[model samples]
Each structure stands twice: as structure tokens, then as C-alpha cells.
Target chain A: MTVELLDRKLLFVTGKGGVGKTTIAASLALLAAQQGRRTLVGEVDAKGNLADFFEVGPTAFKEREVSRNLWAMSMSTEDSLKEYLSLQLKIPLVARLGPLARTFDFVANAAPGVKEILTIGKFVWEVREHHYDLVVVDASATGHIIGQLAAPQSIQELVQVGLVRDQTDWMLDILGDPTRTGAVIVAAPEEMPVNETLELVTRLRDETVVDLAAVVANRVLPELFTRREEKIFERLPAAALAQAIGGPVQPLLDGAQLAVTLRRTRGVHLARLRRELPPEVPLLYVPYLFQRSHGARATHQVAEHLQEELT
Target chain B: MAAKKNPAANTRSIEQLVAAKEIVIHCGSGGVGKTTTAAAVAAMAAVHHGGKVLVLTVDPARRLANALGLEAFGNSETQVPPAAFVKAGVEPRGELWVAMLDTKQSWDDLVTRHAPDRKTRESILANPLYQNITGRFVQSHDYIAMERLHEIHAAGTYDLIVVDTPPTRNAIDFLEAPERMADFFSSRLLRWLTVPSRSRVFSLASRPFYSVADRVLGSKFLEDIAEFFLLFQSMYDGFVERATAVNRTLEDKRTTFVVVSTLEAAPVHEAEFFIAALEQRGLHLGAVVLNKVLPSSFLEKGTTASARAMVSGAESLAGAVPASVGSPELVARVLREVGESFLNFQVVAKREADTRADLSTVPEVVATVPYFDRDITDLAGLLELGEQLWR
Candidate 1:
């Protein structure tokens, strides 16, 4: 189904690791904010690359507004767990029995799905309670995305009934409802990423109930050559060009040839992807960026691009 | 002998590591092409350098499987057909086997092999309650992948076992998984949870505690935990032993870690953290494979001067184009498009080069594989990568 991403409360951006999911996620937030929405772009890992994109130092669990409408933070699982533990259930036990409480801590922390649940639960809580119109999660890559998306369900299954189960149920209500949540898979035009993106789609259909907002194809090669240029270029490999188009223009011819060839190759990959993916999946293309990594200029450029295309 | 203590140099290349190391693990954050890099290094080693190689990949999506031209891969080692190797122009003097980690099956195997007897194994594995408790063990993938690495290494069948690790949440977590596993097994809390005598504290501690737990959880929850512990308690020592062995294998000099990442800001930043993570653990460093980099030649230093001159000349020509053939507006538009793309091309190129320069401080050989014309999804494509990787 085609989803207008802005309408959804939660927008999760995920794909293969190097496919620029974080970049797209940042842009989505920027655009959402530009549209006057209070947007929170959450990063799951403590790595703090989002801060870099926004030209800020590492941020803690406390959300910081990096731009007018955009706020970003990397949630600490421990902090979330602490908040979770402080609720009505465990405060008495931890205060009374030190050793038993410590064991309880170990068991609570070491149990499978606890960390993931905490991370996701924190994000879902923001979506539920925060006044923000949009929450864009810079989720872990494809390998971890499924587990994160399904973390609530897994926890719900594990905890048949309790405060923990109730919390998971609330999180699941926000995530599993299509109108409440949507996903944008960011991918490059390359094969492995597209292959993985396709796998994510199938898993989304079968495993989760999240809506697919759009497929943001990041760093796509922009088309440059015309039919005439292409026809002329077909006969002239770099070697032939070097021999025939000698002298001052040789470097230009060479660079242009390289550019055209790369673009053509990317086009082929894009065509293949189109055939492979569902035609209905909306695709948003983000140009390859060359800006310095230390600032948010590239992100703003992408946000502007997102605004132009998304509308 | 020790990665030359220079991640900045090009001395200890990928080819050298594959030829020398008994194990090379290609690890990094997700989508950085670790599986492809590992497969390439393994194939190159087996076909060109001569060794028995087995590559263990943790790709749940099975993209690596598809890239290797397999319908699917499982826990067992599936040999790459001789014909495929030959077709990829790899004249193999040694065997190259591939497999994807089967976490569930591996978990079961760990339980069976470590259990003292068939009765305990059956009891632990079949326990309705303990099943999820253990099956979904914390950091199970990380622990299992490390165990499988040690298992294959201990077998001594393959000269090299190149592993493609699951994408890690934290670089530190990836490095510490085995230790964490050992810790989990030996933790006093685990012992308390699993041992019937030690388990009674929480259940029998106080009337209020017992009543609260029973009301919050089911009344039978405590009983289930007690029973599950009784069954798994016998296997604790065995689990600890295996975990220690796994740790030893990782610490061995014969084992090396390779960082695989794309030349992007976030991934490169993570790669830096990962390399440090390895160094902190005192692990052997092999080579870093930076994949899908823009080739240096598009506007490499040697070509930019003449290329810049030509682009200006073309724009001027666009200004003077005859109206009969095309309006100056259309010509200018085409020229502008090309100019825009070229600017983008240079931008991407600069980003990669800048990252590459930043990475030179890593003090190990760094291999830069240029963005190929197509996605690598077949054996031939992988062989092409193998060629570039070793070069």
C-alpha cells in the first residue's frame, strides 16, 4: 500500500548497513519539521552518528533539538530500563533485598529480547506520549530490524501477563497498527542491498503489520547523457577516446565517459530493482552527496529534496 | 607476523591475510558487505593460494547465499561446485565450503553436546518453560557464532574459516560476546536461577514477595523456573567449558578480524570504533576491506586539470549552439545536467577519498574495492570481487 509518510505518527527507516538509512531518516525528520511538525529522530545505537550529521556532539538519552522542528537522541537502554523498573512493580523489591534485587537485575537485563524491547519501547513511548507529530527511528540495519520490530510481540509472548506484558501490549498497539506506524526502507542501487531490501519487504508482509511508506533509493546516479551522446559513447571506450579525442579535452572526455558509464550501470540496477520490487512501493530518490561529514548541510539539502519529491 | 602494527600501510594486504591466517572474520555493522568480502577472500584463498576454506555467514536474508549462486544455505558446509569455481575462472587447488549460521539448530546442538547425558538433554530441550528461556538466550547469535567458529577450528579440517558475523549492536558487544557468554554461565544469578536449592531465596524470601510474584506472574511461574533450573543445572559446567574454549579460539594468534564497511560517514565512523574494539581485546588485525568506493580516476589528480578545462569549453559551446539544431535553452539544459552529475560524481569521490585518508591512521593494510558496474549476486560476480580484493 502507498503510504503518505507524514500522516503516520512513527516512521522507521531501515535497510542494509551502508545504504544510508540514517541519512534518509535525518532528512525525513527535517522535512517533517519543515512542514511544522514536531519531529523526533531517534537513533537506537549509542554510536551517535546522528549527532555528527547535525554537527553536534554526542547526545545522551535526553532529546536535543538540533533544528527548528527536528529533535534527535540516542536512547540509552539502561536509562529506559531504569525508568521501566522505577514503575510500580520492582521499586519495593530492589530497596528491600539487595542481593535478590541484584539477581533480579541480572535476570531482567540478561533475558533475551529485554534490551531490544527497552530500546523499542522507549521509541514507541515517545510516539504515544510525546506531543510530536512524527517520530523517525534510525533503526538498526536489516539484520536487526526484524527483531526490533517484532521485539514487542516477542516480549508479549514471553510475558503472558504482568506490568511488563502490559507495557509490551501498549507498544505493540502503536507498532502493529498501520495508521499509527510506517516504514521507509532506505537502499542503494547496488545488488546486495536491493536483494536485502526485497527480503525485508517480504518479511514485513509476513512477519509484521507495519505499513511501507516508501522506498528511499539513496545516492542514485543522476541521468546525464542523451541518445545522441550515448550512441557516440558506445563506440568509444576509454582507450578509443584516449586515442581519438586526444589533447586538451581528453581528461574531460575521460571523466564524462566514466560518469556516463557509471550512470548507465546504475540505471540497469534500478531497472532490475523495479522489476524485482512491488510496483506499488513508492520510490524516492536522493542524489549522491559530496558534502563534508562534519555538518548538517547535506542533511538539509536532502530534506529539501525530500520535500520536493514527497509532496 | 602481527599485522605489522600498521593499519595505515598497504603491506599486509587482504590476499596476504587469506594466505596466512587460519581464521579471518569479516565483521562490522550491517550492510557493509562483510559477507561478500569474506566470501571473496575465502574464494581467492582457496582457488589461487591453495587451502581448504569454510566460510560461515550470518546473513539471515541469504543474500550471500544468492551471491554464491546457491538456492539456499544451511548449517552444514555446502561445497561450491567445481563447475561454478571453474566458471568463475577460479582454478581451485583446494576446497571452498560455505554455510549460513543456523542459530536455533546451533543452540540445540550446544545443549545436546554439553548436557551430561541423554536424559538431561531431553529434559532441558523438551521443557516447555525452559525452551524459550534457553532457546532465546541473551546474545545467543553472538555466542553461537563464536562457538561455531571454535568448533570448526577445533576440527582442524579447513586451513581457514572465514566468518561473516551478524551485524552487531555495539562493536564492544561483538568482541565481548564469548566472555559475556562465559560470564552468563558462571554468574551467581544463573546458578541461583537454575539450581533448586539456590532458587528458593526469591520464592521463599518473604510472604509479600511470593504473593506479589504469584499475582503478577502466574502462580506456576516460580515452579516452572525451578523445574527448568533443575534440568539445566547439570549442563552449567559444560557450558562454561565451551564458552572458555570459544574465548580461547578468538584470542589465538591464528585468528584474525577483518573490518568490512562502505566508504560512508556513518559506517566509516563505526569502523573506527570497531578497529579500536578489536585492539582493546588484543585480537589480531588482518586487513580492512572498504567496499563500493568510487574509483580515484574519475577526477584523480592527474585527470582533473584537463577535465575541468573541457567542461568549461562545453558550457561555452552550449551558449553558442545553433537554433536550427536545437534551442540554446535545451543545449544549456543538457550541459547543466552533465555538469550537475559531474559535480555529484566529484562530491561522492571526495567523500570516499576523505574517509580513506582518515582511515590511513588505522595502521593496517586497507583494500579499496571500487563500485563495480553491477550488484554482485552470482559466483562470477563474487569471483570478480575476489580478483579486486586480492589485488
Candidate 2:
């Protein structure tokens, strides 16, 4: 049986930038924590905005509990490398390794997959050690996510024999399994985002071992009118309606018209996404919350909506 | 402050900026329509100014790519057909060209140009790590894009070149990539990492690092990377000279940056950050193109009262409608829905307005483009977008 999304040990949530990838990842972890699972959510890019979702203070590499059964941290490759050295390699002297860690980003930049491997390795280690029931990663955007998720396999091919090579086997076993780990792609129901989502799905299948757990269509606008009502909406006399309403009604009507046009335009892409995504991949939707604020409150709303979709 | 210095310069539009500058780079956080804005501006330049215009975009939507005749990826520039302009009901005074940045191909070209010998060039191209770096690493995209832009600009083919920067992890990464590239070649760490491969001499200072690296990555992998870097060092002088030239081009007086963003919170925040970065670097801040802005009508006087009236009085309002429209019950439902929808959108529009107001230290020309109802698939749609920024 396929494990439910929340039940997975490791979940890397990624999507195109600006598609609410962080929002979805935050809410998924929030929901899992509320469901009584010990959850850890790591923001991979460290934009420091993930803390805003919970209205908490800024996060560091060290995990902090934001609420009951929930923790948050920001991934730093240097810190991840330090942790890997001490925990896995039994390197106790961080001071001696300090200079090496300082230049880690440069090495990673030159070595291609080194940084990606370190990032993924930390999360996989968390799952392997059973530190958290669920580790939801606000992973890299779609452009770089495949490289990150496939880092272990790439490293395996590059390194003939090493401790890193030995470690890749377990990381692959955990990541490649559908039950323990999966990827959630959060997409907005728009043309470019939908196209990117479809492209990423193919890339994930071809490039990474991670299974697609879910596709979250975020900020989906509501359907404004039924067929009969739409015809009625079109036929309404604008001038006459304003006179009857006792206020300028053009903007009001125009607003609805705009919404309808938006929904219609977006619906085409949504349909394409649904039709093209694999049949087994569950697609969940979170509506456009036309609120004035984003933060802890908005995250709660998103989590509630996700809960509804999941159930 | 600069705008204040030249009072008449307040009216300097994107058109004037493009005409005056050799390079106009459209940059912001991802998915804020940078590619479309750059393309639109280039199209506008071709139509009005009548010279060779090129838009070197990083990533564009598929249909927009098709519209521009960029059906495949490469560094090659293709002219957007004059027929497309005629179809869009515009006759260009000059020509519009398009190119998509293919990172791997551009890196190969860079290697070909900088390598001291054919064998070195061939070896660099064949290196497995080199292939992976060119293909997968994000920073490589930033460096190669700037490198490609410098090459094209130096060729002096286009009257105006509009560039869309890659969506970097940090928006400032690309801006600093050239300098960073130069620094990497001269850094001590590169020497340290490459030491073992050079003479098998492990100095005391580097011994601990080597020991740790060897244990984790194995000696063979280290040797492979050391060999790669040793090979890379052969062309260090040419690479550093090219990187320095790229940096100079970015700071050139003829270059300008157009910051594009929606009035959404995150994108607006990024725009603010980017504008500050540009100012800090002493680069020219030409204009700010605010894309996908909501209609000002949403925040107009007394729209809320009208919406509330519709919601509270839907049934009574429905009764006033003619029988030809719909049944009273359905009419009431539609009325309520419309009102609620308007109210919902008003909340967002108000928020957007506040965010727009929060944009501090904005450039002289801040052009706001209303959200297009449909994606810009053809030249007509692009021209429509361009018109908003032209004035």
C-alpha cells in the first residue's frame, strides 16, 4: 500500500520559485505536527522567510521547537558538513576543520554535486536516525531540485570508493522508496507554472529516485458562476443595475468579470495539469485566500485547507 | 536624489532609457515576468526606435519562445520574423532578435575562446566534472549568462540589448558572479585543493584538510577533482581577464537595470532589495517596471459600499432585474457571489496598494502594467505589455 503523504519519513517539497513552495512545505509540516507526528521542517534555501510562516524567530542550522511536536531549522551547508563530519566521520575537532568549512561553499561550487549532496545527506540522515516522524524540506526550486535530489546517485557515480560512497547506498534506499520518501510539487494554476510543473514531473522521474507524492495546486481561484448564471451575468444591463443598486456598479461588475476571466484562463492550464499528471499522483488544491495578511494566520488557513484536501 | 537633481529627468521613460543605453537588464525575483518584460521592451525598441534590437532571455514560457521563433535552445540569435510584427499590426522600424541562454553551450564557447590550446579546450570539454558543473550548478548559469551578454555586447551588433538575468538563489548572485569568478581563480583554496595533484606535497597547513577530504571523498575522487582544477588553471590568465572585462561592462555607463515585479509582498520585497543592491554598486537604475498590477479601480472610492450593498440586498436587488436575465433565486445567488468576489479581491488589491506604497527609493520611471487577462502568447500580446512601459 502507498503511504499517505503525512506518513512519509522524508518529504522534499519543491516547485518553481514564487509558487508558494515554502507555504506548502510549512503547512504540510504544520499539519503533520498537529496530527501528532513529530515533524521537522527545514528551509533549504535559507531565505529566512520560513520562520515567518509560523511567526517564529529566525531559524539556524540548529533545530528549534516552534510548537508542540514541531520544529524548524534553516539548512546551512557548512553546518551540515560539520554535523556530517562529527556524527558520521567521528571528527571531533570542529576548530581544526573550521577553515575547511569556511571554504566549503567554494569547494561545493567547484565540485558541482558536493553542496547538493551535503544538503540532501543531512535530511536523509535525520530520517535514517528516526529523529523526526516526518522531515518536510522546503527544498530548492524546480530549476535546481533535480540536481539536489539526485546528488547521492551523482556522487556515487563520481566517487569510486569512499565513506561518502558507502553512505549513498542508504540514502538511495531511503529516498528511492515510495513509502519512506516522496516529493511534493507545489504549483500555481497558471500557464508558465503549469508548464514548469509538467516539465519538473518528467525531470523528477528521469533524474531523481524520489517518487512524486503529491501535486499541490496553490492559489486556485474559485469558480465564479454556473453556466446559466454566467449567461445571466453577461446579459445584465450595466447602467440599469447601477441605478437600482444606488452605488456605482461598474467596478463591482468589472471585478466579477475580471475574476471570471482569470478563472477561465487559469482553468485551461489546470485542466492540462490534471490530465497530464500521472493517474496515481494525487492533486490537492488550496484556494486563493483573499486576505490582507500572510504569516502564521495564513499558514493556519492553508493547513486547514490542506487537511480538507488530504482527508 | 538623482531624479531630484535633474527635475526634468523625472519624466524619463523606459523608451528614452533604452534609446540612450546600450544594455538594459530586466532583473527581479523569479516568476515576476522578467522574460516577458525584457522581450516586450525589446519589441518596443524595434518598433519605435528602428535599430537592431535583441532580447537575450534566460527562461521564457514555451509559447512565448515559439512566438519569438526560439523553438530550440542555443546561444544563436534568431530574428523574430517581420511577418510576426505585421501580424501583430505593427511595422517595425528596425529588427527584433531573440536568443535563449543555453548554459552548457555557452560554457563550451567560453572554454573554446579562453583555452590556450586545442588539446586543453578538448580536455576541459571532455572532463566529467566540467560537464556536470556546466550542466547542473546554479552559479554556472549566472556566470555564463553574464559572459554571453558581454560577448554579444562587445560584438556591437544590436542597437539595444535587453537581458533577462537567470533566476539566481540570491538575486545578487549574478551581479557579483563575474567578480566572484575572478576571485575563485586567485583564491588560495584552489591552490590548496590542487596541491596534491601538482607535486604530491601535503604541507602542514593543508594536511588536515586533505586528511578529512580524503577520508570522506576518498583519495581517488580528490585526485580527479585536483586534476580538473590543475587543468582549469592552465587558462587562468584568460579567464581572469575575461571575468574582469565582464565586471567592467556591468558597471559601464551605457548599461542600466530595469527592476520588474508584481505588487505582491514577496516580489515587492525583492524589488526593494534589488534596487538597493544596484544603488550600492553604483550601477544605473534606469527604471522599475511593475508588472501584473491590479487595476486601481479595485481601490477606488466607495467600491466597498457597493459590494456590501449587493451582498446584503441581493434578494431585493435580484427582484429589480428583468425576467429575461434569470430566475430570481439564481439571480440573487449570482449577485451575492459577485459581491463576495469583489470584496475578496478588494482585500488583496488594498494589500497590493499598501505594498506598492512601501516601495522605498524607487527609480525615476516607475511604470505599472495592469494584469493581463491572458498570457502573452504572440507578438500582439507582447506589444500590448510593452505599450504600458513605453510612456
Q: lDDT of all the models against the reference?
A: 0.73, 0.87
Winning candidate number (DockQ): 2
Q: What are the chain A TM-scores of the candidates, in order?
A: 0.88, 0.97
- Pairs that collide in candidate 1 are A17-B30, A17-B31, B6-B363, B6-B364, B7-B362, B7-B363, B7-B364, B8-B363, B8-B364
Q: What is the lDDT of residue A242 in candidate 1?
A: 34
Candidate 1, residues A73-112, lDDT tens digits: the string is 8877766755655554645544543344554456454344
Clashing pairs in 2: none
Which digits, one per residue and each the tens of the lDDT, describe model 2 over residues B1-391? 4544367676778888999999999999888888889989999999999999998988734435765644554469888888889989988999998888888998998889878899988998999988888887766889989999999999999888999989888888999999989988888878776676546543543566667777778878877887888889998999999999999999999999999998877778788888989989998888888888889888888889988999999999987889888999999899999899999999999988888877734678888899888878888888999999899
Off by over 4 Å in 1: A1-3, A87-105, A108-110, A234-251, A276-280, B1-11, B128-138, B195-229, B315-340
lDDT string for model 2 (A1-311, tens) is 27788999999999888889999999999999999999999999988989989999999999999999999999999888888888877757567765764467555766668889889999999999999999999999888888899998888878888888889999999999999999999999998889899999999999889999999999999999999899998877778778887788899888999999999899998999999999999999999999887899999999999999999
